[model samples]
Target: MEQAEAQAELRRRALDYHAQSPAGKLSVIPSKPCKSQDDLSLAYTPGVAAPVREIAADPEKAYDYTGKGNLVAVVSNGTAVLGLGNVGTLAGKPVMEGKALLFKHFADINAFDIEVQARDAEHLIDVVAAIAPGFGGINLEDIAAPMCFQVEEALQKMLDIPVFHDDQHGTAVIVAAALQNALELQGKVFKGVKVAIVGAGAAGLAIAKMLRALGVEAVYLSDVHGVLHAGRSDLTHWHQPFATAPAHWTLMDMLADADAVIGVSVRGAIPEAALSGLAAKPVIFALANPDPEIDPVAVKRLRPDAIMATGRSDMPNQVNNVLGFPFLFRGALDCRASQINQEMLLAAVDALARLAREPVPEEVQQAYGFSGTDGLSFGPEYFIPKPLDPRLRQWVAGAVSAAARKSGVSRL
Candidate 1:
């Protein structure tokens, strides 16, 4: 009864918070002053025409004359939103707006949340491509798997500005960073460790690709049909790359000898029996949102030697995507990157891992309500840098911008 009441209170508070005056989490304000008559004329009629003409003559002038360079369109079709599956466009606005809010707060990037009524991947690509000129980058959010893969790939090929599906790559970057630190802390070699990933959706597949690209050779992925293998006829091209040769393996079989098991699936996806199969001092990243695949407490009981991470903010080593998107876009926007590529992603992963090993700043400790000696340090419990860390802009964003420039992807 108490639990039910607590949930009810939370629901009420959330609704009320969103419902409060202004009615939404975001707003548009004039970056340039528009108070006086001269300012109004310059902002609207006469002066606007000058920059408009300049942009018309040379499209690249849009960056110099307007906010286009720092603007990102957070586009979504609402096929997948948070832990709520297939919430539709209208229902997904809050999540998109929250993303916009985060983008603004974290990296000072101007984001406009755009929820489109896309029928399919092609429709989404068309819609985003049509509006691509206005934004320095396009951030695809909350779209479901298979379709998301298509939409992101198509849009990236079609548009020059960075087109990123944050659900896929953002999650992948943070997961890689966390795993890097976790592996090192446990004295496990990156390429030597075996990983079992539950959930072959957007996040799961992206993580698998990233880990492989980072040199982890043995990566096993599982979906609703059990482990992905060459024997599975239901597998698509997206799933085929990560599938093993052939096996009658269950989720447990994958975990049996895994040095790390990452879960991006729903709650209770990791069975209690699987915990016993993990190698000594294993890394467990059960990152299903709202709830994890296995309860952290349960994992602790099963294997006291295990280093566990979750999607929950209250937990240690939280694999949050906020640690990725803002800084990534910040770097991309700053550099005028043509696209977000593997080199940039790898740079972000390295930067985050490097930041985690550095000494925690006092302001960062204070942001999370910690003080003095009650601060974080580099260890199993603090492997991933806190999302509130101030150094992220300098470290991660700087690294990404440099990588973009080095890879010859920077338009500037």
Candidate 2:
């Protein structure tokens, strides 16, 4: 089929798939039996009052007496919905539901997707803070850039439970892991490589910070206004840390001679001609969804030695956030973590990077229809684990939980 026809068919099938269900992607089911009057008594009213009273007396008892320990609220204001951008709360419901689905399917965690129509950043923060008592963790989703930073920072400080903006931290964790393996494959060192990041939005900024934390020597961040330089009047406070050192350079100039180029920007933002200027065997992660900043095929044609990745599932080394969030939250919730700290994130990254180097299971290979023995091996094309790999839950969750304990964030 033609690309347009294929997309149309996918749209039709997606609608049918959602409509065929009980009208949506998710539903709440009782964890315990509620078939008899005896069961009902224990599940509610007089019998349930015992646990409620215990929780009221000692607030920490809620983790034991109620479902709060394993429940996450996937909250969103919908100011940025993937590539669609600022589609509002209601329109962003499907994506949030999909996130909830991943949480359940991947890590056996329960999630409630909450779409809040808040007036502003403060209102969103206030609303989330008010309803946060029932959840073990909060996964903030789809909020815009500067506001997203503000909302996450405010919530993390106010709430004792783990408050993570998945768009920022999730992407950061996966990208860091992939970059680790990709650098090794190309015989490059993190501390020596010059990295250029396009689109200094939530994901881009977070990735830059995480890379720097992982010991990358130099990171150049560029938004639509070109390279972020010191004293730029338009730069937000969050963008200030990433501003280049008193130099004037276009995005193309920054890309030139860099070891890697990561894009979280819009489609076609990075010019194809600029690929030639990159260091030999450059690592390119054109991570814009549905479409990338530079076409992978064109990149390969121009620089076949380049290591390439995208946000699409069909691509090799796809940096999907699904690889991080579910398991990260699982570990955090299991350990009764107070916050998702940097140590936890670094542990998650290391776990993922290590997992990719191991041999792929036959089951995972079969699921993705890999026929050859070499298909799953770690290399330039296979720098990250596939999203459906069941081992992610065990590896990432365990590492994160251990890190939480070591970092003094775990209540368990």
TM-score of each: 0.98, 0.98
Q: Give one digit per residue, the lDDT tens place, for model 1 in 227-294.
A: 99988889889999899835878777888989999999999998998888889999999998778999
* Clashes found in each candidate (C-alpha, N, C closer than 3 A): 0, 0
lDDT of 2 at 46: 76
For candidate 1, give the lDDT of residue 243.
92
Kindly report which residue stretches of model 2 are placed more than 4 angstroms away from their true locations once superposed.
none
Give the alpha-carbon lDDT of every model: 0.92, 0.93
The candidate that wins on lDDT is: 2
lDDT measured at residue 337 in model 2 versus the true structure, 0 to 100: 98
Query: Any runs in candidate 1 off by more than 4 Å, and if so which?
Result: none
Clashing residue pairs in candidate 1, if any? none
